[model samples]
Target: MKELNIAVVGATGAVGQEILKVIEERKVPFKSLRMLASSRSAGKEITFMEKTYTVEETTLDAFKGVDVALFAGGPASRAFGRDVQAAGTVVIDNSSTFRLEEDVPLIIPEVNGEAAKNHKGLIASPNCSTTLLVGAINPLHQKAGVKRIIVSTYQAVSGAGAAGLTELEDQSRQILDHKPIHLDVFQHQIAFNLIPHIDVWQEEDYSKEETKVLHETHKILDAPDMAITVTAVRVPVMRSHAESVYVEFENPLSPDEAREILAAAPRVVLQDKPHDNIYPMPITATGSDDIYVGRIRKDLYNDHALNLWACFDQIRKGAATNTVQILELLLEKDWI
Candidate 1:
């Protein structure tokens, strides 16, 4: 492999740190690595791969000489994405700002990796829930021709970032002490609670998190007209995300057969053994790179329908690892 110049924007954030870890753990050959964050976080130093690097303030010029830039920032990602691409760097972004754009290809490499070759200097990683959802569903779609999907996500509070985690911990302590719970990171007290809302409401009263699943799945699978409905919820869990997915296929797909296919699917770890109470859980999937899938069973009403339960590290595979996978695809194809 050739050594390339790589940079990670928003290096101080959760997903950004994971991106660095993935690159290090995968032993990606890089001639140079740069870390950039906001001015507030600039000057911070991180030790990775036994080497220390300082985080610089992100700017248009920071992308200079970079071959591939992984972005794990917020809406600010759009600004840096344009700058990075203008500097001749390919940006693999982990934000919603670019996913719906016509020119940017929304990718889950395992499903539509070829789409990376179609990028106009930028590519998008899907939302966390969508990432895990597609990983477990794509194989079945290819085999049975999926017609409809109904999914409900149990997303961890960490999805809201560091503040969310702190808030949950504080709330738990407050509740245990019989004190008033605080609600800083969420609309309601997240400790020992579930918030059905994940993002701002949009058309038809569906949350942004819910709608992203519908659109991104279609684009990734090349099934623009497929029916996909999702409900995104924020739970008090610290890490990882879990989902209950119901899939209706065009062809007959039995539970046993679905289990067989999912077991052999790439990046999916099968744990379906209901009799022994073994199944995928957020706690078990906290640091996993693969999607843990189980609870396989046929829907009583439809012979072509099956229900699945899946869990995965929301920060790793969903954001950072997938972005790295895109870079790997570009590298393998010599696109970057």
Candidate 2:
């Protein structure tokens, strides 16, 4: 691979820091790496891949001469996406701001690698939950034609950013210490409690996070008309997000067949042995790059529908690693 100048926008945040680690763990060849964050985080020193880099305040000119810009902040992506692209640098944004845009490709390299080539300048990474959702089943959808999907997501506090994780820790500690429980990072008590609401409430009552799941799945699967509904719940877990999905396909697929298909799918680890007590869990999924799927079985009543559980590291494939993968694709295609 040709060495290219890589820039990381929002390089100090949780996801941004994860991106830096991923780039190094994956051994991506880069001529130079630039870190950009908010002015508040500027001048902070971050060491990644055994090399220290200073975080610079993000500016329009920061992207000049950059080849691949990996955006880990929502506001920064919205603020600098066009600027970087204008500077002849391509951006792979891990933000929801452009996922639904008519032009930007919401890519999961394993599922939609070709879509990266069509990116005008910016490519969007789907929401963490959506990334894991689409990734777990895109292959199945292609073979069996997914008609309807109903999913309930157990998202981690980390999905809300580092502060969310800190809030979970603080609230849990407070509750244990018999101190007053505070609710700021989360709307309600997130320690030992579940918040069904994620993001703002939308038109009919579905949360924004759920709406993103509905829309993004349809788009990434190339089934814009596919009917998908999601109930997003914030679990007190630290990092990995888990989902229980029920999918109805046009063609009936057996549990054994589904398991076989998913086991061979890219970036998926199948551990479906209920009798042996083998299954995927957030605890095991944390810090791992692969999405784990298990409990593949045919619905008791509907032979056409399949029920499964999945878990993924929200910081890895869910956000950062996918962005880095897209950058690799761009470099390989000479699109950067």
Which numbered prediction scores highest in lDDT against the true structure? 2
| TM-score of structure candidate 2 | 0.98
Instruction: Compose the digit string of candidate 1's lDDT tens values, residues 219-246.
Output: 8888998999999999889888999999
TM-score of each: 0.97, 0.98
RMSD in order of candidates: 1.1, 1.0
Counting clashing residue pairs in each candidate, in order, gives 0, 0
Where is model 2 more than 4 Å wrong at Cα?
Answer: none
- Cα RMSD for predicted model 1: 1.1
